[model samples]
Target: MPNEIPSRQELIDRAAELVPLLQKNALWGEENRRLHEENLDALTESGLLNLRVPTRYGGYESDMRTVVDVIAELGRGDGSTAWVMSVFAISTWMAGLFPDEVQDEIFAKPGVRVSGILSPTATAVPAEGGVLLNGKWSFNSGVLHSSWNTNAAVLLTPEGPQPVMVAIPVADLEIVDDWHTAGLRASGSVTTVARDLFVPEARVLPMGPVLQGQHRSQANADSPVFRAPFMATACATISAPAVGLARAAKESFFERLPGRKITYTTYENQAEAPVTHLQVAEAVTRIDEAEFHARRAAGLVDANAAAGKPWTLEERARVRLDLGSVCRRAKEAVDILNDASGGSSVFTTVPIQRIERDVQTLNLHAILHPNTNFELYGRVACGLEPNTLYV
Candidate 1:
């Protein structure tokens, strides 16, 4: 049977429905240290994996708002699932940045899934009709199920080592199971190693031009989603998941309030306590703030893309600032919820504890780190160019 492509709302609703199932399998995924097969099956069946594929290839060709909404919904279920989906969707969107021939072959695969890391951690030495890739890349989310992987490497050229983006089949690389971490453990973000592997020249996309809004694909030039500033949209995509995770934490904290008693206190119901009231108000407000910043960032990026405008320095800096704020505020909200949930919340069996850890991990990410982005934004606000290559 052919897969039915869903409307954006339908896909978002489907993701919401999967929350309970994802919660049920969350422990299994954590224990196994990879995305649960059941969760992956459900995601694939729902057509969520095709959210960013071109419409001509039976995909939804979803926009940034839909991407944020769907991933955020999934984050409420399992952070790992949501994280993997965010990476997959972003990488799939990048396929449209490649030349028509590359996009044609990549999207041709049935139920195509792509995963990637944009950091140029590998080296590509020039070779006949291609380049020889020899290095390793880490934090490759969703590597386990990907059909193709987009990697960034410094190309050995006469001028200098020009960093470029290349898409290669998963069958051509080696997967190293080194993703053991404190949070987002189920994401299976293992390392990929390629030694002396030949990647065809046609598969490479120049990173410099793409970052500057110069694209090689005439086929997708008219697509708003394809024309957006790459790094800004990418950061926004990952930032949305943290908002959903924080919301889950808030909901879990409140749901247990009705029957709970203040520990070693005279209060019979925690819900009636003034402290509980204040904590709930504070956490909920923080979550709202986080969601506001995330949505704002997504809106700005999408609007620019729709208008076919290049991002000014301030616009790019603000997106990073907004993303960092989202992660910071989300983590802070989860922390408050954790404290409010009492001692039991720290147990391994408790979902809130896991959510807390995942949000902390999310904040620790270099891309989402509050301090780093703040500094970068500060630099740009001071009328200086930010040193980061991503913008």
Candidate 2:
């Protein structure tokens, strides 16, 4: 069957229908740690997974805000699926940032998909047209659904030193199937390996310099699609699901409040108690704060792109910090909400337990790690040196 291009609303609507099934299967996805074929087909057919590709290659090319909204909505149902889709969709956009010839080769087929685990853990040897890549990439979310992947490789040429993005055909790469985790377990994030794979010159892109808004791809000269710093803003995609899971936690906590019994208390319903009010309000308030900033970062980045200027390093760091902060706040809020449930929310059938673990798990992402991002932002702001060039 052919993949169909869907409007932004259609994707949201489709996600609306699928979320419930996902919610029912949330634990199943977590236990399996991989997306089910049924859900993959639905997303692919609806085109929810194709937002970032260029219009010429059959993508929606919608702004980042729309993408955030859709992914957030999906997150409210299942954290794993949302995380995978967000990364996959963003990688599609990142592909546009590659050279035009690279784009032509990768997206030559309609509705083709791309997924990556952007750890930059590969080696690139200078070859005739491009570089021969060899190394392993881990945490490749949506690995099962993608036809191609963007693997980060350090450019090692006799001429000089450089960092590069190497496009690898999914068929040529090997999956290590080693993803085992407590949170976002459904992401089935496996490791991919490539050894001495031949890549054309245009297929390899410089990492450090191009991320600052210069690239060999002249096709992007006429379009602002590739003008934005999709790398620094990367955490936004991962963070959106945390916000959504927090929202779900808030909702689930409230739905049970009216009829919940308090351990040994005379009152059978906890909603009437003052402690319930305090915890619920705190959870709701924090989740609201998370929502605002998550949207704020995406809106600001998209607004800048629409304005024709590229995203700055500070702004990029801000996205990283803000995203990490939001994820942390969301998890904290949910923790409070979980406490409000006494002991019932801890059961296997309750689902809150899954969400709680998922939120905590998302906190471990390198880009979304609060302490690391805060220190990076703090250093950059105070005129100290940053640890990594990417974020």
Which has the greatest lDDT? 1
**C-alpha lDDT of candidate 1 relative to the true structure:** 0.89
Worst 10 residues of 2 by lDDT: 1-10
Worst 10-residue stretch by lDDT in candidate 1? 1-10
Give the per-residue lDDT digits (tens) of candidate 1, residues 1-391. Answer: 4546677788889999999999899888888889888898898888888889987788877888889989999999999999999999989998889999999999987578899988799999889998899888899999898899998999989999898999999999999999889899999999999989999989988899888777899878899988888888898899978998998898788777779898899999999999988888899999999999889998998899888887899999999999999999999899998998988777787889999989998999889899998899999999998989887
- Which residue segments of model 1 deviate by more than 4 Å? 1-6
User: What lDDT score goes with residue 285 in model 2?
Assistant: 89
What stretches of model 2 exceed 4 Å from their correct place? 1-11, 310-312
Pairs that collide, model 1: none
Tens digits of lDDT, candidate 2, 1-391: 3435566687678777777767877777876878777777767776776677777776777677777778888888888888888888777877887878888988898778788767789888887776788888888888777898887888876778677787778999988989888778888889888888898887787877666756666666666656777564476666788888998888778777777779888767888888888888888889988898788878877788789875666887788778878887889888998888778777867767888988898888787778888888898898877788766
TM-score of model 2 (CA atoms): 0.93
**TM match of model 1 to true structure:** 0.97
